[model samples]
Target: MKLSVALIEPEHEVNVGHIARVMKNFGVNELFLVNPKFDSKKATIFAVHGKDLLTKSKIIYFKDLRKFDLLIGTTAIYSNNRSNVIRDSINPSQLVKIIADSKQSICFLVGRESTGLNNTELSICDIVVSIDTGTAYRTLNISHALAILLYEIKKNSFQKKTNLATVHERVLLIDYALKLAKVSGYRRHKTSLLAMALKRFLGRNLLTSKETMLMVTLFRQALLTIERKRRKMF
Candidate 1:
């Protein structure tokens, strides 16, 4: 999976430079800035060896986020008062599965240095993740949170398949399994539970298209056999 780090309306140039340094430290090179408020020299000084990263970082608008398969918003204050389902943020650890599953582009979006992502930004995100900082300090430095999130992403990124399963293949695996289950005498509720569990299991594993197709073939064969037996019984 390709990972890009984006800062939106960042007011501090030094932090942006420092974030670029940490991104290089973790081998993340794609940096994006949206209408930043920092000077170039201050950024170059703090970036140090990461000047190349800062140099290549893109100056983008929010509309440009469509370039990614997933646009993730980062927040420090994960309030329980999330107005709706889309606003709720998951823990960073839970995001590892998403990184492991797809071979698509991802953008990690962080808002201004003074404040975390606003509701409007968060609303457009595919996912929102928050780092857990205890009550001592409710929020984290934008750079610090980026470091933690990047570390988690890098940890799970080592799992490589020759050809990773696409979203369609992933969905089809469960669909085929459910058809096989229903035709082979499983109750609807029971089959539903099984499918849910299977989806969870499959979601965490790095499966290739060939592996998924093999399972699909097996399920199809089983369903055909079940159909023949039912015809004879009738």
Candidate 2:
């Protein structure tokens, strides 16, 4: 999986340069800027030895971000008023585990230096990630956050063996199971419960496509048995 870091309307050239330096340290090549405020000189000075990253970086519009498969936004604020869902931000180790099996291109999105990602920008992201900071001053510099997140991601990338199931395959398996339950005359309410139970059961096992297919066949057989019993009763 390819990983890229994206900065949305960043205001500080120094932060951009520092982030580029960090990206190079972690072996991350792609850098995307959306409407940045400064020119190349400011970034180059901060980049130090990592000037090539800034030179080759892709500056794109917000609309073009759709090309990436997964977008993870970063934020520091936790206001109840915000519409975006705030979940536990994964530590570097955990983040690596989550992406180990993912096949899609991943984008790490950082908002402007002055203010973090707004609600609307956060909405486009598949998930929101945050760095753990001291309560005395919870906010981290944009470049610092980028550096830490990239370091963790790179560390995890090297060690993880990617075998986790894809979302599409899991959905297909669930659909098949639901169809089988319906054919067996499971009541609508009962079917919902059953589906939930089955989902939990399957989730625990982390079913692969082959294992899921085997379960599907077994469920079909169970449905057939239920149908035969119903006919006998009639």
Candidate 3:
């Protein structure tokens, strides 16, 4: 898996530098900073060997999250309530399981130091992850949390040699699937849920470019078939 780290509006330059150092420790080179508050120069003092990352990090927006084939969000706050799906999260080990065999490009998003990822950002993520503290103190330092995540991923997961579908291709396939769902008589509410559910299925499992294309074709053909039958009935 091609892994990247994205810090969403990081508040402290020290944390950014520390996280970058940890990322380099785990062999992760790509860093993305979204609307950061601290100066890159200040952070480099802490980075030591990872000083280049602070200088070379990409600045991105919230909408740009979709550019990643799989986006994993980190949250200090999570709930057991089934109704609260946005905060529902898996542990870092579970995250390793999800990406162990996939060649897809993945990004792990770390939120602000004080509040963590908001509901809107969590909803956009393919999966939300929380490190198990096994105690009352659930929140961890931003750099520590990021270190745990990257260490687990680097230790457990291996990059596979496969021609996986790009984020754009998978997104197009998802849109086509939603179209197929609408034509197949699924209710609007169900279609929305299907969109979320489909992301888990498509993102966790590795699909080759050819496999994704086949699925898209099947959806289009089904939609066309439904349209023809409807016209004949009219």
lDDT of 2 by residue, 1-234 (tens): 788998998887788889988888888889998988877777799998778999998889997887775677788865553222433244555566566646567898899888878866765665567776767576899888888887776556444434444545555677778888688566776765555445434433445567766766787677788889989999
> Which regions of candidate 1 fall more than 4 Å away from where they truly are?
157-234
TM of each candidate vs. truth:
0.67, 0.66, 0.85
* Best first by lDDT, ranked: 3, 1, 2
Q: Could you tell which candidate, 1 or 2, scores higher by lDDT?
A: 1
Cα-based lDDT for every prediction: 0.77, 0.72, 0.84
- Candidate 3 residues 15-41, lDDT tens each? 999998998898889999888888888
Model 2 score (lDDT): 0.72
* RMSD each, Å: 6.9, 6.6, 2.5
Error of 2 at 216 (Å): 13
Candidate 3 stretches with Cα past 4 Å from truth are: 157-161
What shift in Å separates residue 167 of candidate 3 from its native position after superposition?
1.9
Clashing pairs in 2: none
Worst 10 residues of 2 by lDDT: 81-90
TM-score of 2: 0.66
